[model samples]
Target: MTLVPPVTAAFTLEQSCFGKLRHSIRAFAGSFRPPQALSLRTAAHPSTSSVIVGFEASTWLRSPINALHSIPGRHVTIAFRTEVSDDGELSAWDVQSRKGQYDKVLNALWEMDLRELRVLRIDGLRWWGDQKQLFQERAYPFPPTQDDEAPLFARAWNVEVLILTARSDVSLLEALTELPAARNKLLFPRLHTIAMEWPRHESVSRSIVVDLFQKRHAAGLPVRTFQVLRKGGQDERWEDLLGFTQVVVHDSASE
Candidate 1:
């Protein structure tokens, strides 16, 4: 799995994007771009067994995402970065534009089969538009159609690892904890591990983390581990993350 680099940028398959996905020791990292185009409409990839199981794009788009989803059963991870992407950097202009673009990508993701998706990593809370709206999908409810799978934007039921390397903000955390239609609905039913690195946020506190775990535990959800990343920033509940999950402070240095 380590060898399979995350498809990033214009969903580019390049070495630099690998650096973005492959967490390095000692320091930190940035975003990525696309290389040569690799169309999937004609046929499956040359070797689709496990070439890429993840996506790491800053501003996610629908076309490339659709192309990626065309290949069946290999979708394992999907990431959203804060920086400008190769797809359409103009969306960074304002909140309304970002909201529209982000909304479209979420709709595209909704249509895909994401059962095998294990890891969901999101970077930069800045990209999140209209803090209250879940991808501006208030009117658009869960599962689009009765037969459609539950949208990840609404609830990533099978996601095991939830990674939040975003900036110091609670918006992303709050959004991840619930959905637009089901605000009270707990997210990621199978989520067992949470790795976060948004430290010293005025809004983020020990109670927030505790509340997250408590709510999930009360619902019979398994929040077995909490990985506090100290690479960029730190959370206040360093030593306090004990009851529901093992309080493991993860450092930036490589293992």
Candidate 2:
């Protein structure tokens, strides 16, 4: 039997009102708003298939909030920037602040009633901090503790494909581990494909992709598929991607 392609759609929201944006998208696609909770089976329409969301610009704190939670959809993808500055110099406040933001988003998504979730993607990240001056930095850093990234999507209805790109920090490797839950858990127990792309030589990224696969397999979530794509910022295949996905990546290079 030919596998049916899942229904997919993309979403982009501004930074200022991402909180509301999250609720809006969920209400629109999910068939219920924040103040309400509905079963995915009941909410899904005859036309409902699969949807994918992408954030082109950096929402910073807002990005995590929008992504951490699992929506009652077919698929979801989240991407962010990852470029660390002064490798060894990192700070405590930076780590905590970034983790805190992600925590907020995850906490919210965790509260939803997701049922048909399939694919999940987190990408375009940059890590910049100094170990010696971690606390003195004004901007918060990301990929907090390797432990913090795992709890975001412990239960994703029926996720099948997973993808990660441009992640300079290895902390996300933990994202693959399924959080043990009560019986009849709706988590991604049948995930099939996993894809991740990072800067070629960044040991952090290399170690992460390796560890992610190993750990998930050890945990009985053996990955059935895998793909790695190098992210080269704008020079990367933005146009090719647009053509491939039939979604315009926008010609901003000249602007």
Candidate 3:
């Protein structure tokens, strides 16, 4: 009989048992390998954040993760959800808190302590402060703001994969245009992949936005593979429109 270390046994069994039960088990195990002594292409940094609701990270912790004013030299994906606020309409207090969040994330990234940082998936971005009559009382919709754009632009210009959920806003591009590096037309210079999720919109026409993106992409920008997954049945045109950036759009519904 052979004896096995509890930790290794647990891990191996978990891998086996879950591998048969779950599709993501293999990837999850793969990510468990020890982090290497980062070998970066350029002197850059990257961190990845998930944009899912409960996973939204507070900006206060950026420094500890980013290692204080020193940019990571390799591909560092700074992961963050594009949506900062739960409800889009920022009350006076919400705005203050949001600003504080922005300051924390940007100050850390702006230190240029990273080689590359990418903004990952943002799903379920509702219209800023729109009203929907649910039961009786009126409620405020979530508002996406300009302040949230700095860290994103900083990462996009410097990182590898920028993944966003379908509900993300077009305003992200506006914010990119204002970045000091991007203003000089260097936003996403190092970007290789953009994973997007396109939400359905009845009133909004996305062609205008897609056209603008293509023009910029041709001008030496960082957009590489653009992929979109449509979840909510808002429209099918989004898939075609997303192609302007040469992005592949997948139908989440089919998956």
TM-score of 2: 0.43
Candidates 1 and 2 compared: the better one by TM-score is: 1
The TM-score of candidate 3 is 0.41
RMSD of each: 13.0, 14.7, 15.6
Per-residue lDDT tens digits for candidate 2, residues 46-105, read 111122332221221122222323333332322221222255454886555544444333
| Model 3 segments more than 4 A misplaced | 1-112, 118-157, 177-183, 200-205, 233-235, 238-244, 253-255
| Best candidate according to TM-score | 1
Candidate 2 Cα deviation (angstroms), residue 62: 29
Q: Could you give candidate 3's per-residue lDDT for residues 25-110 as a string of tens digits?
A: 11221232211211111110121111111111122113212211222222223233222346556688766654443333322222
Top lDDT model: 1
As for TM-score, the candidate ahead, 2 or 3, is: 2
Minimum summed lDDT over a 10-residue window in model 2 is located at: 39-48
Single out the weakest 10-residue window by summed lDDT for candidate 3.
129-138
Error of 2 at 235 (Å): 20
Off by over 4 Å in 1: 1-102, 125-143, 147-151, 175-185, 231-240
